[model samples]
Target: MTPFTIETNQYLTQETQGFYHTDFGGVNLPNNPNYLYKLKNDPHHNWSDDWIRQSQEQLYRVLLIDLPEVQNHIGKNPLTICVVPRAKADNTYNPNQLLFKAGVRNAIITLGNSFIDGTNYIQRHTNTKTTHLRQPIDGYNNDGSNPYVGITNATCNISNNVVGKDVLLIDDIYTRTVNIDEDAIQALISKGAKSVSFYAIGKTVFNH
Candidate 1:
């Protein structure tokens, strides 16, 4: 996929890309694209708030189509999306919370910790049962003390999520961080995800 392209849906194919036909019938890019595209310039007090509130409903619409895939892999929706927000940001976006009403039939979980006191995106999406893998308190991280707490908690959370079943992890952007995300996936596999694949909504205008 190109850098700007997003994962609209898993089942989509060449015939389906520009085609508009499904159980729901007819899918078009400009006319209800698989997912909404929200740039930083979009409205909102904060970037996290803007993305969570805007992308949830639309994103879930596509995510539900993959329910079979999710069940095949983890057996449910409301599956945890390990959203890693822009660095130096607070409360990264979490898709699980937003996909609840759209048809997520399970609990949601947050991977990384949120700033401003656990400002989780789960609340913004599904009110269904969920959990947060607390980013360990390793002193104020503002001065670049260490960012491992969040990733560490993520590893632990992914490792423990496998209760004799597979799981899915979500994230927003993936590039150089693929290695880092791979690390998280490794941890998830260690915990019990039959497989770990990502549904990246958007790519960076700038990739490090």
Candidate 2:
């Protein structure tokens, strides 16, 4: 399938594109419920073995098909995989990390371990107000003052430097605004990643 381009806007300096396997109709759309949305939002109930297996299956399909296309776009450079970190409140075995690991394992089995590094390099420093009900601009900040500055002070745990590495940033969902995802890409680039491309299961379309 053709990938969708995430256009550069006020919050982003570069155009980061990605592909979503399914469409998510904004928030609280009872008539059009999305499986990916259910998995992300209701993690407490959705973290069962059956749910996890299903989630992995869906992600595996994407890695098996969409990932190769993304790799072709980047040429010879290997891509390291990193998930956009969850809020501090979700530090304990969050669904995002679990989903990322599942996809990484599948990638390793098919593409080889060298192509994708499953490193939890980026992390949240503190908890911020949930962005679930807010606009993109109302999300985290990196203004050198806010406690939860998105990826501002996010830790990079790689032993060797990532001076010229290409990074494939993964997130569970993409909002209409770019604050969180853009901050994440910026943080990775700032830490010496040569370039960053994004991927997610779905992109939200706000009703308003």
Candidate 3:
């Protein structure tokens, strides 16, 4: 699969680089369903053993095919893998972590357990209200701060020790307003990350 690049100006000095497998097509509504819609909505909440197995298989395929290309793009920087924190509500069992673990299992890139540290370093403190409609370029805080202001402010508790590390951030979906992902990048950079790259399984393509 050819990797498509996603550029974002959320960071002033550094632009976040993103890559994904396919377009999100559109919002996953009950009446209008797509793969990403089904995965994100997960109306039945079927993220069980079977779902995990299937998701692992799918992620393995992506890593097997695309990881090499990603590595080439990243070049030879000592790398660490981080993930966008799941919502405070969804920490019960994050399927995103499961998917990432699967990818690591099949990855050609050499990484140790210390490299994949999403839960330990960065985290989400509050859950934003869910909305199907589009909103302004705003952060998720009810206080009218940046959607990820907490992260940038270090209130979400990011480790300030990653000064020289190159981080590869992972997420399951990419939406037009990728504030959370971008904020995570900014937080990492502020904490001293040398560079950050993002990858997601799906990129939302709004279709009116």
Candidate 4:
């Protein structure tokens, strides 16, 4: 299996046991009001200042720039953002085709997956996998294959619908060895997608 490559290791620069830090409230931001636009989060973890900056920076580098190579391979159609297991807090802030709004292009697709999502399937049990590292707001591997519980590609609308759309998917991490994101990509191809790429801010050290 082809392992995911690692780019910047600033996340590894520090001696952090995990990607997140303590919740020190009142953190300063870049003065942009709508900075926190589209994020798939867990209900339990608060959006701490450090968490926001790290995630945003990583997306900027990987999602926006690094994966342009993918576009070269697959003709650009439009961006389709799919969120699996939408955070309870951002319940009303569901996503849309906001690639244009986010200054990308006139093509974008945004959707969310709640508890029974087929997109991203987390497999590890809480204590063993440590994915639920951030309690209450647990993140999982989107690689489940079981028809009932596994990550089902059919669940993502874009999977079978996109014909030649150059895709960029933004999420929090890379967990699975041969996991759900790949499943979603295949699903997109089935949907007629030209290409699909992924980006995430923090990945588990052991996931390497």
lDDT of 4 by residue, 90-187 (tens): 22333431221232221121221211122322112211122323333335442323322223333322433345554454444455442444454444
Candidate order, lDDT descending: 2, 3, 4, 1
Considering only N, C-alpha and C atoms within 3 Å, which residue pairs clash in candidate 3? 139-146, 139-147, 140-147
Candidate 3 residue-wise lDDT, 1-208, digit = tens: 2355555564434666778766655554432213333334232444566665665566556656665566577673445666665544335335653445435444534344324444346655545433333553344332323454434444356666567887877766666564666777777877788887877776666622
TM-scores of the models, in the given order?
Answer: 0.40, 0.71, 0.67, 0.41
Q: Over 4 Å off in model 3, which ranges?
A: 1-13, 26-44, 89-119, 130-155
Q: Number of clashes in every candidate structure?
A: 10, 0, 3, 19
What value of lDDT does candidate 4 attain over all alpha carbons? 0.35
lDDT tens per residue, model 2, 16-115: 7666555567546753324454345343344566765676676677667766776786563577777775544336445654555556556656877547
Whichever of 1 and 2 has more TM-score, that candidate is 2
Higher-TM-score candidate of 2 and 3: 2
lDDT of 1 by residue, 74-141 (tens): 33443444432333223333443334222222222111121011113212111111111124334423
Which prediction has the highest TM-score against the true structure?
2
Give the CA lDDT, 0 to 100, for residue 76 in model 4: 45
Worst 10-residue lDDT window for candidate 1 reads 12-21
List the candidate numbers ranked by TM-score, top first. 2, 3, 4, 1
lDDT of each: 0.33, 0.60, 0.56, 0.35
What C-alpha lDDT, on a 0 to 100 scale, does residue 188 get in candidate 2?
69
Displacement of the residue 121 alpha carbon in candidate 3, Å: 2.4
